[model samples]
Target: MLIFRRAKVEDFEKIKQIIKDCGLCDCDLERWLNNFMVAEEDGNVIGTGGIENYGEYGILCSVAVLPDFRNHGIGDGLVRSLINLADRMGIKTLFLFTDKAVNFFERVGFRKTNRSEIQENCPESKQLSSCPLSFIPMRLNINEFFENIKCK
Candidate 1:
């Protein structure tokens, strides 16, 4: 069985290893641990995802699932949980940079967006690091998602 929960301080190294193994973006644990979550099974972490707050905008970053565990909805669960966190934090919009898995995030309501949208509103995020040209930008609004879920 898969277990999903908010990540604790102790889960960083394991989660970091998972991110590295999957070739996901690197993150500073000290900067992001509070918003990170992990999927575990039988004492081993199998997946991870996290978010970075930029006030009205949030960055959805570093979601990864083990290769052997793909196609089992683990990645979707991680995204949903991160979205929930964004909603609770009063984040209005969330965006991500991805070189791969664009299809995966699109299924979860992220739509391809102009790079300047992020660059203009979230200069702080761009200041944090540079995104490669190959990485496409995608965005979603937390309130919009919540509204759709309510309608459903």
Candidate 2:
């Protein structure tokens, strides 16, 4: 069985490897390690994701699942868990930069947004600062997401 839980210090290398395999930036990941969530199966870390808190806003980052773990709902579970965490943390909006998986995020209710909007709103977000121009910026409003879920 697969389970999602807060990432532990010992899971760093596994998380890093998964992120690297997915071609995501791993710089400064350790700084926000405490906020990360991991998907573990039979005591092995198969996926990881996290958010960078910026007061009322946050940047979802590092969402990745191992090749063998893809399409098993691990990535979706990790994202949902992180969204729940963001809601609990009083984050009004969540943003992310992704070169891939835009469709996946869209299915989860994130909408594409202009990169300049992210820069203006998330000036202090380290993830945004280091994100490449090619990556698409997306955002989800926490309250709106809950409302949409209820409607469904």
Candidate 3:
């Protein structure tokens, strides 16, 4: 069976490997591992995702699934898990920088946003400052997401 849970320190190397395999950034991963979630199947780490908390704001980063696990809902599950974590942590808004998977994030309710918006809100975010200009910025309003879910 597959399990999703908080990433442990021992899982660090595997998580980083998966992230790198998926063509995502692995910079400063250790600093944020506490906030990461991993998908493990039969004792092997196949995917991971995490957030960079900034008080009421957060940046969802490093969401990745192994190539063999893509399209099996691992990525979606990881993203949903991170979103739930952010909600529970009182994050009001979430942002992300992605050069790929824009449609995937859109399916999860993240809308295209501008870099200036991210800089204005999360001035101290290292990811924001380092993300290339070609990357697309996306935002998700946590409160709105909850409200919409309630309505449905």
Candidate 3 lDDT by residue in tens digits, 1-152: 89899999999989988888788886368788899999999999999999988889999998998888899988988998999999998899999999989999998889999999889888888788888899999999998876776322
Per-residue C-alpha lDDT of model 2 across residues 71-90, encoded as one tens digit per residue: 98889889999999999989
Full candidate order by lDDT, most accurate first? 3, 2, 1
Which segments of model 1 are wrong by more than 4 Å?
126-128, 150-152
Give the Å shift of residue 135 in candidate 3.
Answer: 0.8
lDDT by residue for model 1 over 45-137, one digit each (tens)? 899988888788888888999999989989998999999988888889999999888999887889999778987767777423666788889
lDDT of 3 at 56: 92
lDDT of 3 at 49: 90
